[model samples]
Target: MKTLLGSQDNWDVVENGHEEPVTTEGYTNAQLNALKVVRAKDKATLYLLYRAVDKSGFEKIANAKSSKEAWDILEKAKNGDERVKQVRLQTLRGEL
Candidate 1:
């Protein structure tokens, strides 16, 4: 999946997430163009993520607004929360 996303030049967007360009009264053509590009990439990456997950995973990310959100949902579901991980590690080391 990482390889596929990287090939499409969308890995960065998925990994870092994008800051939506703000449009204002003073917005320039360049900003509008950048906004279009950002939206397009966000949708594309979201589509890829939606297709990659199974039914259960799909449920977790169904309302995600961006690919990064969907990716984070799957990551947390698979690896658990950071606190959970810490507790698990401590138990394994007989310190919990």
Candidate 2:
């Protein structure tokens, strides 16, 4: 599993597991890379991943795609949607 730095709240597991005492540092590069890859393929996942990485990742993802698509992905992901998240995870794992 990958570990991210700069905020644990940006993780789906952390959110779902209701983990307490979120941290803002100490993430592995592999985890950060996975988060970036996930965000690139799905905006919703990107939003969640944002909580772990720097804001620059968000800007990059947003700039890489259309505003409409980015917003749509963020909205859907924020609403607890999982389809896109699953797809993003699969892509990150290179199982797609």
Candidate 3:
């Protein structure tokens, strides 16, 4: 997934997340176009992510604001959170 996104120059959007340009004060055409590009890439990434996961997994990232946020949520769900990892490691050490 990372490789795929990277090949299309979208990994940055999914890794760092794109900031939506503020529109309250109005913007130039260039700014709007730039935002459109970023938004398109982000939506594409999101579509890929949605297709990659199952129902339960989908639920986890359903409310994610961005690809990066969804990626993070999925990663933690699959790998477990830091505390969970620590506990698992402790159990392994005890078994040895």
lDDT of 1 by residue, 1-96 (tens): 899999999998898897764545687899778778878998999999889888998999999988898898889898876778888888999963
lDDT of 3 by residue, 1-96 (tens): 889888878899988887775562587889778888889999889888998889999999999878888999898887776778899999999999
Candidate 1 achieves a global lDDT of 0.87
Candidate 2 per-residue lDDT over residues 4-92, each given as its tens digit: 41243234432332212255267688966765654444444345445544565465445534323444445555566477788788899
Q: Which regions of candidate 1 are displaced past 4 Å?
A: 81-96
Q: Candidates sorted by lDDT, descending order?
A: 1, 3, 2
Clashing pairs in 3: none
lDDT (0 to 1) per candidate: 0.87, 0.47, 0.86
TM-score of each: 0.77, 0.22, 0.77
**RMSD (CA, Å), each prediction:** 3.8, 16.2, 2.7
RMSD over all Cα atoms, model 1: 3.8
lDDT of 1 at 84: 89
Q: Which candidate's lDDT is highest?
A: 1
